[model samples]
Target: MKFLIVEDEESLRKSIAQYLAAAGNICDWASNYDQAYQKISIYSYDCILLDLTLPDGDGILLLKYLKKLNKNDGVLVISARNSLNQKIEGLSLGADDYLIKPFHLSELYARIMAIVRRRNYNGNNVVKYNELEIDTSNKEVKVNERLVYLTKKEFDLLLYFVSNKNKVISKSAAVEHIWGDDADMADSLDFIYTHIKNVRKKLTEAGCKEYFHSVYGVGYKFTDR
Candidate 1:
């Protein structure tokens, strides 16, 4: 999954990014409110790690903006403040979960996954679409009871397609979803096409029906029909 870390503390931010990346997630970091605002305005994420306080502006404003825009990006507020009212406010403002600072990174990962599962997969860790079964917890995919090997990127792409089945997802969005902020530096979107092709080949070889359709001059869509 893709995540945005809205944190000012350089060490903690880097730590969170490294941890999530190691877990096969794409991460983007923003040190202050303005940077956070810009990222949220442009890109979407599976979840966002928001710190309640910032040097320039309050983090609550960002929450309000997301609510105003009606974006479904899950939010997990990570703040040092332990006040009851602050937690209440953050939750009331649409934060999926809240974590007090000085907490374990493992706990943070667990919470983020819980939120994403709840919001996206309706609280199910294992996502099933027809004959395709994805055990997200174990990062395993099976088609018709046959294990299908996929690279991390290929697995992520397949999961993404399943999450938004039937929607025409542009190559740029796929690139951003997989590479996070690094997508901007990419010279072209040829890698996106390559990953999708590999995923299709693997699934088809595993006896799965073709669900991916390339839309000329646009992008691709995953649909049963």
Candidate 2:
């Protein structure tokens, strides 16, 4: 999953980013409100770690802006403010979860996983399609009750396809979601084709049907039909 860390504290931001990265997640950091706003305007994130107090503006306002863009991105507010009113206001303003300062990184990771599952997969840690079962919490994929080893990118690719089942997902959208702002640096989207091919091969080898389809001049779709 892709995450945006909007914390002004340099050490904390780096620590959080490193932790999430180690867990096979792509993370981007923003030191202040302006940087956060700029990043949000350009790239879409699966989840955001936002600090309520920033050098330029309040995080609540930024949260409102995020909602305004119809992103529906999961947000976990991390703040030093532990007042009841602050927590209430942040939750009421569409924050998915809240974590007070001085918390363990493990707890934060758990919260993030919970929120991501809730937002994208309807709170189910396990996502099932036919004989294929994906345990999002464990990052495990199984076919017919047998474990199937998948590279991190391949796993993420499959999850992305399943999440948007039956919809035609553009190559550009996939690139941005998978690679984020770095997509701009790519010379071509040839890499996506390679990943898709590998994912399809793995599933087929596991006795799964071809659910992924190319859309001619458009993009790719995941459909039973």
User: In lDDT terms, which candidate is top?
Assistant: 1
List the pairs of residues colliding in candidate 2.
none
Instruction: List the candidate 2 regions with Cα displacement exceeding 4 Å.
Output: none
lDDT of 1: 0.94
Model 2 residue 114 distance off true place after TM-score fit, in angstroms:
1.1
lDDT of 1 at 144: 93
Candidate 2 yields a Cα-based lDDT of 0.90
lDDT of each: 0.94, 0.90
lDDT (tens digit, per residue) of candidate 2 on 66-146:
878988789999999999999998998889999999999999999999999889888899999988899987999988988
Residue 200 in model 2: lDDT:
91
TM-score of each: 0.97, 0.94
Error of 1 at 29 (Å): 0.3
